[model samples]
Target: MAPVAGRPRPGDPLDPDAAISVRGLVKRYGDFVAVDGLDLDIRRGEIFALLGPNGAGKTTTVEICEGYRSRDAGEVRVLGEDPADGARAWKARLGIVLQSGSGDSQLTVRELVTAQASYYADPRDVDEVLALVGLTEKAGLRGRTLSGGQRRRLDVALGIVGRPTLLFLDEPTTGFDPEARRQFWSLIRSLRDLGTTMLLTTHYLDEAEALADRVGVIARGKLVEVAVPSALGGRETAPATVTWTEDGARRTEATATPTAFVADLATRFDGEIPDLAVARPTLEDVYLQMIGDDR
Candidate 1:
């Protein structure tokens, strides 16, 4: 089959050479188009985060890549093979953890993990898998019996038990508390250290910044931009918002060189800049601005 326009074809460039690649991916729902000419490349062992508003086409794009849905038009390769025609072998090479994981809610965590491991030819040690996700203590508990964070961890354990080279995490920490979120982040880092490529989607901007080596933002059914989280939308170049209190009055300014401005303000007041805080636009700030502008 011919590749979609402005996208990589199945035989071009050859992706077993690349971990994941998508070209001119198009998905539509009746009169509404969900994805428009999307193209992306994800290298092995990198955590790539997909970001967007509620209906910005993030989930639809992910579903297509996962082979859960076929693209209306496009050629996609995951783990170096076309996901649309992906086989059992290709499927086993990848792990997927959805927002709602396969909970044999009645099945113990150990049972679920063991069963998943059985599906693969060379799976990770069940015990090692539990340890990797920090769920050893709860191994005996049924999936449904675990707390939200614990269930999420079990979900992750199941994903890795098969020793997949690539893993997909969809809003893995949606209901987690602060500490739980941190723990999950550590687990993700550990997975990356072990050479697992990850594709992540999250509503939490901080989560994206913390876990993703790079992020792609989608707006209005199209990918508007992609960059390292810290540098998205030239956030690194955007001036810092400097705020201070003088004569009991608060003042602020956007400056390219905050340190210089701080020093000058310090001299003007002949003392420390009162209540001074130099804040750069955060990934969240930039993301919100971009999405708002697109709308």
Candidate 2:
């Protein structure tokens, strides 16, 4: 089993190799606490997904890391520098793509990307970034003329033109269709392969399972757990639910050794079992349970 990560002790030293690290993170609004004593560490070159329901402090925490918001208390280090004190060089090492984008600009695709590329010290070639996001075909089209998925792709093109070492993506696939989402996932994986560290926040459980190397769930202003998608909440060791049709009705049982149980059932019937099915808790199931969502 993969090792699970938990909150670090208040005095624990910062991880030297971590792309982002937090200790005793806290945030508040008037009488409400949005984040409380949270600790997390995201390694370099890995895609880390932050998952939480609405009003769960996910955005507040991410904003603090991105240096867009001030924290009431805690320590945060991004790219080995405190975000609050980040300089131009430090800022250039990071890229941000917000949930909503300015894709309605009148500039053409290549024009916008080229303009964005000029902001960094060593940006990727304009045409290559466009091709990487599958936007080469729409290079000449104005942003307002592109479809929703195409516009999202354009957003990514702009985000990566700077060749940032660390990128933060917020709900990147919000307007994408299934096929488009899958294509975007491939682009993200390719970025990870090229040694770009990423921090992602999204409502899609399947997307997190597909792309994230590690996932951290936040509930009511605190981190609940951090683990690989398959092993979150001990799901890997949880019993499997086996179901089959028997005696003119359906029956079900949960077992840890599903393979042995199935073999025994096969012998009892002396043939293939009718309507046999095996299932386990899904990522969504565990996430919802973790957040205490009774609905």
Candidate 3:
């Protein structure tokens, strides 16, 4: 069995009206604590990103919120009800896209989505959902026949067929190529425009920067920081890494303001700085550093 992550942090007070509230949340496996007194506030109609290194409790936390796993202790309210005790009707208001397990593969895309809609009181039109996911062209294709990216899109289509108020996207772009990932991002934005509150867990920091309004970073199972992407892990304040070429030798420096440094370098060289480039930390760069994976 995978070891339970035991390092969830106890943070400051959270605001009321949070769509998902977790206070003092704890989950255990015999002698180990998977989650420890974690507190988080996911707001309504906003994209909230949950991130951590592998085995850092990201998946477990999402499962607990999805009502698929129970917590040993904590106060969790998802969409005004405790998910542990939520009814089917309450669940219909949520959309979840997991990595696998929609294998009615012999079924057509339309059939698969339509079948899921039956569980909801009122579902969006199957064709409309397909169109929303950019899969309308392949609606008649059997699930097994679709390409990997297309199949992933169908998984998402099924997730949103009910027009859920809150959506949980678990690594939606994991297997997607760069182009497919960009296309998927557009579909997510469309859902967001409809006022769907989203909880997104993604390994791809670029994906988070593109989608999340705020991001939380967890390290060794503990949430160390929660902030906007530009400022996550002090990314904005971390010194800029400036790169240039002088006498055909590449050189660099870490400084507070690369622009000012570049200006001075330009005067020293009496011209344009050779191969000049000012670099700030990409979301991935800062994320790797935070996770202790910097090399």
Candidate 4:
């Protein structure tokens, strides 16, 4: 099958080609385990989405990988270095866009981006970064005056100004409207085209479907499964629901052989079947089922 748009085929993250790798990871909050024996690998240039419900260890795992939180056990390697021991040079190789951001209210977009660029030994052009995140027009706008979506773009601009090889996006579009969300997705796709490896955590299933080459579902501190979005959780092989309109009513049947079923329906009608649809389980369906079973 052709690869998903804006994403490449999945590869092993531990094969010396991975941007991020985690093995037998574990994290505990005293009596409770937030992450337990999880293993994951994100290839050098693919967008990987991590999904789970609240209290499912998603954030903890990400934090550990990003070197913000310490892991109780297991090994993690980001950009071939342990984040806990990563130096300024090592950090410059990674970009992070958190769910929320903090900035001086009076600083203009250009000023903020320029200041961020100063931290790295080598950084992308400030104006180019602004344009890349769709903030070129708002370069002179103060941080306090920008709308929510524009501010989010600025956050992204700051994240990428250092030309990071890998990016971590945590709930990147939480407050965006549909149109703004789509625009942000376009920006992300552009970054992926530039060969940026990304680890994304989001609750939006469609966003995951649209951007992720591979998705790993986490629950109760463990990774339940990891697969390409189209085939995740065995969705590609799951039974399809064949439906059609008949005598002013709708008819539906669940079947594994949707093609044969459709052929029979066509023979019955002796023409094009009315309102025919063959629907398979979506990524969201499999995700919910996996998390639910874990609980």
Ranking of candidates on lDDT, top first:
2, 4, 1, 3
Pairs in clash, predicted candidate 3: none
The lDDT values for all models are 0.85, 0.89, 0.83, 0.86
Candidate 4 RMSD computed on C-alpha atoms after optimal superposition onto the true structure: 3.8
Residues 114-222 of candidate 3 have per-residue lDDT tens digits of 9999999889998899888899899899999998889889999989999899999988888899999999999999999999999999888889999888898866556
Best by TM-score: 2
Error of 2 at 7 (Å): 5.1
Candidate 4: misplaced stretches above 4 Å?
Answer: 1-15, 247-249
Among the numbered candidates, top lDDT falls to 2
lDDT: worst 10-residue window of model 2? 1-10
Alpha-carbon shift of residue 77 in model 1 (angstroms): 0.8
Tens-digit per-residue lDDT, 89-172, candidate 2: 998899888777754789999999999888899999998998899998899999899998898888888888899999999889
> Could you tell me how far off, in angstroms, the CA of residue 282 lies in candidate 1 after the best superposition?
0.6
Tell me model 3's lDDT, rounded to 2 decimals: 0.83
Sliding window of 10 residues with minimal summed lDDT for model 1? 1-10
Better model by lDDT, 3 or 4?
Answer: 4
Q: List the residue pairs that clash in candidate 2.
A: none
Query: Per-residue lDDT of 131-161 in model 1, one digit per residue for the tens?
Result: 9899999889888789888888888998889
The reply for model 1, stretches above 4 Å from the true place, is: 1-16
